[model samples]
Target: MLQLREVNIDDKQTFDKYITKHNPQISELNFTNIFMWRNSYKFRFGEVGEMLCLISVPDNDEPFAFEPIGAYTKEAFIQAIDEISNYFKEKNWKLVFKRVEEDKLDYFKEYFKNGIDITDDRNNSDYLYLSEDLINLKGKKYHKKKNHLNSFTKNYEFEYVKLTDDLIDECIRINEEWCKKRSCEQHRNLYCERLANLEALTNFKKLKYEGALIKVNGKYEAFTVGELLNSDTAVIHIEKANDDIRGLYNAINQQFCENTWKNTVYINREQDLGIEGLRKAKLSYNPVKLVNKYTITCK
Candidate 1:
């Protein structure tokens, strides 16, 4: 059986080697995400050769594993899958892989005897956009976004601040207020997200996060957190803005990319998780591309 350990900040270096190399471009592959959601999702890690394997137990779903990260080879995946399957069997759980890239399905098909059951997990597909599109918002398609940003700048006395130790507390307070307005305590997923946000903010430095804060009228009203997912891609993990503040969303979205992640070619804002409003909001920006993801179940 593969020896799995709880995810921790200390494991980041070791994990990043494999994660960065694999560059799955999936949000879950980011170590910060795995670490922040560790307790909430019961995330655990193990290693097979140079590959990294992970398993998570979601409260509302059966325990599932992630596609092994690192050197992409048939032998490594087979070994990791077999070892993980044995681990699940001992616990009497089904062996399932979540967040499996659709492009990798053919490889798995060759490994399985009768082929695996692959399902389109549209809700979990990541929306990828050109960093330039977000920073510039120049073309006709971005006319509305430009208006929103302009409206915000013209109406409010606001400043963009780089996230530092002294400013994290303000961001946390803003997050707490946002949670109250959204009634996160009454919702499981939102509640979990709040917790995860807190964990990330508290351990922001140790997790190596880069973020920005928007201060309106000398008060922190919005914040965004992200990190380099790979050599050319930066992933935005969290972006919170006061909805009452017209154009705050557009402001933070544009400012964060312009200031902090300008060098990265692509910005991955992550998934919508089947929420209609969220899907619409993400699509409104006109993503340059969508990262197709899948769910695989081994028979």
Candidate 2:
């Protein structure tokens, strides 16, 4: 079994050394994603055959590995997964890989054949959009979205400001009210998401985040955080708005893209998690493609 260590804020530099070199598609490939949800997922990392290996052990579920980061060769990956499988066996848990990106799916199918089940995890797949489409909101497809942004612009005295550490208090205030309205206290997933939000904001600069916030009618109402996932795509880690104010969500999203991410070709808004309303909202923007993630389990 490979030795592993807990993921910490200080480990960002170590992880980014591997991640930045790889061309990652899914949102999970970034350190911020792992670091922010470290509480729920309990992520640990170590090197196997010189490739960075990651594993998640949730408090309520069986442990599983993610696709190894850094350079890939069939020999190195096979050895890494083999070691990971044995590590899980020692703990008496089945070998599993969750959120495996599409490009790496072939490796598992060809090398680890027997008793392996590979299924698409649609609920966790990322929604990718053309940065231009999101920023410009051009044509008939964006007619409704354009209207919403226009309404917010015309009605509210709003300022689109850079999300800095000084505004953390205002961000927290909006989040507290948003959590109550969404009934996050009664829902496990929502509660986990709330914690993720706090984790991102608290470590904003350390995580390499570039974010934006909307001040509507002299009050802080909405904000979003995101970072470059790879050479071409920027993934949004968090987005929150005061739902009581119509079009605030649209304003925050549009302003963030227009102001922060125009240099990137694609924007990864991330998954809907099988939430009906969330799915509808993401779909309304018309994603260019869906980056499908898969889960593989050895039976």
Candidate 3:
């Protein structure tokens, strides 16, 4: 039987070593995301054969695991499938895998023909943007973005500071204020997101994240957090701003990319979760591509 354990910041080094070898392209592959949402999603981890597996046991949903990490050959994945199947067999549920990247789909077909069903998971597909496109905001496509940034600059005396221990509390305060304004208590997803953001802020340094804070009139108004997803891509996990303020979103988005991730070729803002407003907002950025994701259900 595979021994599973709760995910923690202490597991970062081990996770990083395995992650680097595999270099997954999906947003969920990042360790920080796993650590922060550990509670909300009931995440657990273990090793089976040569594969590192992450399982999500949400309260209301049927439990599922992510596509296995590390060097997963077809044979190794089959072993992992067996291990997961035995663990969940008592539930009388099919073993399901989420966040299965496009390139990895063929590996599933190699082992399970009639047992597996792979389908597009558009809600979880990641949006990929050119880092240069976000930082430069050049051409007519970005006219509105530029205009918003300009208005923010003209109206407020603001400072963009690299996030540090001293500013974490301020960021938390601003996050609370933002949540209150949005009535997070009424929305379960937003409320859960607030908890995840708090965990990230509390363990920012331990998680090895790079962050930026925005101060308008010398008060914290916005902040963003991200990390290197792979050699060529940086993934943004959290970005919150005061929507009431006319261009704070555009300004922070531009400045954060310019200051922190200029070396990367692409930026992944993660998923929109099928929210109409969020989907529209992400689409407006004119992503260069969408990293298609899929769900694999084993019957």
Candidate 4:
């Protein structure tokens, strides 16, 4: 019998081994993402042959999975999916795959052999931007962003520093203050985000994430944490800025890329969760790609 255990920090190396081989583009495929949101989603995983099977048991919803992570052949991959599907079915839960990347749709078709319910998970799709575009803020597309960045630069005497364990506290403070201003406690998503951000910082060194923070007038007002998602791209896990500070979000976003991820070809800012305001903000940056995610119900 396959048994699933809650996702933990110790799972990073094992998950990384499988994830590295797969070189996944979807945001949820990473171990950091799995671990950070484990509290909210009640994520659990188990090993099945050469694959790692992860499932999310959200309190308010049916348990679901992302496509299994690892190297696989057609037969082995389909077998792994069947194993996971059975794991849920035993408990009377219908297994569905969430955040399945666009490229993997064919695999599901093969598994079903007839038809499957594949729906767009546009809300969870990640937004990817060219690193250079963010760094330079050039051209007509980025006109307003450049102006915001310019306004921030001109008005604030700010310092940008590479994030380290010692700087983690300041970053947490910034997030906390931001939460207070917005009354994050009143919002479920925001409250969970606070927990997730704390988890990330608490395990910053363990997870081996690279990050940067900004100081305006000797106080930290903004920060972001990210790590390499694949060979060509880096993914930002968390970014927070003080709402009172004009243009601070723009300042931190540009500087974080310039300082930490310049060598990477693309910066993945992750998902907007279908929030209209968030969608609009992400669109304003003019993402080069909106990585599509899907939810596929097995037949």
Model 4 lDDT tens row, 1-299: 56889888998999999999888997778888888999999998888888888888899888898798888679768778888978877988887899998888888888887688999988998999999999999999999989888888999899998898999999889889988888999999999999999999889989998889989998888999988899999999999988678889999999989888889999999899989999999999999999999999876
Q: Please list the C-alpha lDDT of all candidates, in the order they appear.
A: 0.89, 0.89, 0.89, 0.89
Q: TM-scores, in order shown?
A: 0.97, 0.97, 0.97, 0.98
The lDDT of model 3 is 0.89
| Candidate 1 backbone clash number | 0
- Candidate 1 per-residue C-alpha lDDT over 1-299 given as tens digits, one digit per residue, 9 for 90 to 100: 88998888899898888987797677778888888889898998889886888999877888998888887888888888788878999999977888998767877788777667889899999999999999999989999999999999999999999999889998899899999999999999999999999989999888988999999998899999999887888999889989999999999999999998888999999999999999999999999889988889988
Q: Which residue pairs of candidate 3 clash?
A: none
How many pairs of residues collide in model 3? Answer: 0
Q: What's the distance in Å from true for residue 206, model 1?
A: 0.5
Per-residue lDDT for 113 in model 4?
A: 79
**Cα error, candidate 2, residue 7 (Å):** 0.7
Could you give candidate 3's per-residue lDDT for residues 1-299 as a string of tens digits?
Answer: 66789998899987887788778899989889988889989998888777888889999888998877888677888988778777778666668989899988988887777768889999998999999999999999988888999999999999999999889998898889989998998998899999999999999778979999999997889999999999999999999988889999998899999999999999999999999999998998999999999999987
Instruction: Give the poorly placed runs of model 3, Cα more than 4 Å off.
Output: none
Model 4 scores a C-alpha lDDT of 0.89
